[model samples]
Target: MSENTPLPIVEEDDWYRDHLATVDEHGKRVWIYPKKPKGKFTNYRTVVSVILLVILFGMPWIRVHGNPLFMFNILERKFILFGSYFPPQDFHLFVLAMIIMVIFIALFTVIYGRIFCGWICPQTIFMESVYRKIEYWIEGDSNAQRRLNNAPWTASKFIKKFSKQVIFFSIAVLVANTFLSYIIGTDQVLAIVKDPISKHTQGFLAMIAFSFAFYGVFAFLREQVCTTICPYGRLQGVLLDKNSVVITYDYLRGEPRGKIHKAVKGKEEEAAKMNALLGDCIDCKMCIQVCPTGIDIRNGTQLECVNCTACIDACDEVMTKVNRPTGLIRYDSEEGIRTGAKKIMTPRAIAYTSVLGVLVLLEIILFATRTQVEGLLLRTPGMLYQKTDDGYISNLYNYQFVNKTSDTLALEMELIGIDGRIKWVGHAPIAIPNDVTEGAVFVELPPSELQTGKNKITLRVRSGDRTVDQVKTSFLAP
Candidate 1:
């Protein structure tokens, strides 16, 4: 800011920029019009929306092994992810997964800034691209919505309002059902639908709860979901830097704006003021109207702005009409604008991206290395090895098996490392349940192989031709 530059009439206190930038003169949350976005970025957003829709709707239908590709049964403390089965014993893996996720989010925010808030976040996706677009279609654009809001009660108004509510709630319900599919699995969701109401009271209640929350949040809370609710939005200031790319006003190019008529049209001396001196902007306030968060980008970048680029489209439209070039407002940095420089890939960004890449690689490695089947063998406490009538030293042990695949497996245990032979006390081989762990079995070794005090042994469990699990335990010998 220069000494010649006039102070913002919107805020004129004896201080610097106000922290509460988005509040109106009355101190209420300023409602924004956000003139329908167009141009290159808007087109890019459409492609992303389609990809998200497909992934969200397709995940529950995907099956890996004999189980849903991903299912979180918190009630049972069981989870089947990818093709691997996990029980309570695998909780450490889950904790590690969550830690990785949090770190990834933080690192991403530190570099790319609010790209997640504007483009990738589910709340923004559903609100800006999906729900709001639907509303615009049904009720007409922003100005029409303003008129309808002010218009006295009428049949047309009633019809439009009723239709919007119905559609909003309907979509919310569908979203809830799709969300539930991830939790309980598509098969179970289908079962709940097919089963009698009496059989699924809890499921029905859960559906209701999800529907109400989704509907209320989208319909009523709306943009406040990002501003007031989202913890990430609150954290943007700390995560963001002046070098980060964000939707911003090129103050050097756009400042000293004046009315079109006052811009001096024909006279050579006056024409220079309109052409080169006066700047590209005409200060029509088109950008202000299109802001979702209702903060003027011209006031410098603020936390409230989600960087949706609605202002860019609106400003571009204004510039085209006024015979001036666009991008007075665009995805640029304050530093870039001040120095007349282009966006740069700074070292901070590179470092953050490198960290993200490493995290992703580690996640992939962990997933790949996860064992398909879980096996454990432990000697029964306070029990000594018994000599069987058949001249075998028998030791009671507990066996637990987790079948990672979709199909049931018939498995058998074998002994290795200083053992004569392995035999189950009862059943020779047992059927392992699919997507679950079943506990059973006892191991016996020939007396000829038994040591004095204790013998160390390795037990291998086999399914088909594959060695699914291996366990090491001490065999007690008296």
Candidate 2:
């Protein structure tokens, strides 16, 4: 800790250090303006972005049994996943599903590192491919973008800047609508758009709020979301190990690094010096220039790196220009880079895989054991047992119907145990909502029907004029 002691190299570990732009001596949030990336990986990412964009935008309309395959209607407290309805009563199931998903993500991250952050995540897909591309399109590449920012707002600058904002805001609005569709369902989103002011006033307002936030995030907020905001990104240090494959610089091959051109003699000497002191790296700073998180990979693994492969592509291009073999930077573990170890299946990875297997089995078993039909019978409040003309004791009972089915059910309720006659107040079969429980009526009979002090009464509900659900209740008597 003394001034005489050299600062130790910052090692990446369980705790993530601040990878933000604005930070105090105590790690904190600061703004960052990342240089837009280009090269092979960026090209691959663009293709991937297009595919993801289609899937994201298309998901709302993709129907499962005429319902959205995915809808989390927080407002209605109704969740429909893959056409299976989950009401408030299924909250335990929802919690379990969430836990399973979180564990799956953790296991995947432990094995493969932050490939999700770079490749599959919506944040990265939108920011890197959509907004960043637009930024590059309007403001030019990194250096020109820097220059344009520094330059005053002339008519030319004003128009270009204005155009970018207009585009950004437009995209945000589209994104907001798509995002809201997932929460409120495609039908509600359509109602908002089609009916506008009259049908969905609150929903319309919510859409606007979401759009503005998305705009702010993609435009001004940018990389801070990954560096400072995202908890998943923060979890990477704990989830990832030395064996996890990450975007890494091969310092052994590329270090003691100097410009390859600078060390050149003529032809053979140029190649030899290029192979010697300079390694393969041209020191073009292209990798640094393209990084979205803006931390140098050559400085060793840092929390800021998203493993987007921008550096790999950039370095490969540099190698190509100098007629050298590529991969100065690649997806590799620190051990792999140092010891030339390939990405073999390790003990830690096997353990994660085993855990994942167990989780999958548990999920399957839990799903398989779940009941399809359920019922609830409640005694009508303030109603006592009544003696009928035929000496039959009648008890007024409220019956609830729960049908986890796609088809409309016509349930025939029957009271079983001892001698009893079941009659509905309405003489109609019990019917329920498509994905909800409906309450109706029933009356049970016979004084001798009560076998015990408090008899066990069973009410059976039939789906097709046959018994499907059976509910047990305590029959009360003096």
Candidate 3:
């Protein structure tokens, strides 16, 4: 074909585009039976999935500075990340961290498409590597699995189905326990497991509920979690652009597709001539068969595509067998495939990157400057100034101190500005517990040093010689 010559137009009915690949015209679910993928990329993904699984299941048991490495104990209104504890007072920091994570995900998605879903997502890792592999082992390949599902209730089919169910359920239970450990702590989880069901009824029920949810998702829901449920998959339309690198089919090199013909005795020259006019693609549908989400790469990028690179491996294998160059399906932007130009640093992607960097830096600064103790001082309600016997006006105030650190604090309140006295109702030096402490104190100021009406007074909370926290409250004065 000449450069000036137009490519052949392969027109087909657009009915397939009207609905999803995993659903029928009546909106019923269409079960996908994807052929097991095998290649260099698959092996690499297997290694990555194994590492991620180890981290996921082991993180709750791992401790840093006597605290779980990562935990979100929402019930107790406490959270810990990398050993740093975040109480309810520091909830804003958690919100900021979540926002930063969102920005990072957005930036990554704009540059790399949905590679995270395929490579690092927990659901994809467990489904494809663990559950799917087990299914293949017990029920054979895609064809065999389909046949077994469709066949009547036979002893062989029953055994395979029962075995797969048993394994999936057991794995789901383990997954649920690991998930709960991150929420309630591993020690509590172990205690619940060891204790009787009646002793920890709520925890037992929660574990059972989580186990069933996981089992249902991996066993029945499957790819619908990505295509229909997960918000990240839907966000691809907004986050991804033409410059984003994704698994794509090189239509420019593989189009005008034709089947390979065997060399015959009399038609050697004819077959060679025919092959010269055809593209590298042999019209093999191996790419479609290996797709987990059941979408054809040759049809262009679709929402159902997970960017798993399974199609790339499958297409490459077919190309090798046919003595053709590989990469009929590969990781390339749509712009690269269309204009033969690949650009990674688009303006939108750079803007997102810059915003994400700023957010991360701000979060780091916040964490660095955060105080270990929080103090609150407020004027007592419905109380006026009391004239003291020493010609001084005294204001009764309520104080609350929260200690975020693990150690207790010996706190003493001191007036910051003018010469004044802080007389605690109970004792001279107050001992603040690890969590929270509340008390009342009277701040007495002489009339010569005080202004009329309301006056601002600063109270400094000191532990030994170091001022740990400070607060300002309005004091009633005449």
Error of 3 at 109 (Å): 0.8
Model 2 off-target regions past 4 Å?
Answer: 1-36, 196-199, 261-275, 343-348, 369-373, 381-393, 415-419, 427-432, 443-449, 465-467
Weakest ten-residue segment in model 1 by summed lDDT: 13-22
- With a 3 Å backbone cut-off (N, CA, C), the pairs that clash in candidate 2 are 22-30
Best by TM-score: 3
List residue ranges in candidate 3 displaced over 4 A: 1-13, 427-434
Judge candidate 3 against the unseen true structure and give its global Cα lDDT, from 0 to 1.
0.88
lDDT of 3 at 225: 96
Write out the backbone clash pairs for model 1: 65-406, 66-406
Error of 3 at 194 (Å): 1.7
RMSD of candidate 2 to the true fold?
4.1
Can you give the TM-score per candidate against the true fold?
0.87, 0.87, 0.93
Query: How accurate locally, in lDDT, is each candidate?
Result: 0.76, 0.77, 0.88
lDDT, residue 320, candidate 2: 87
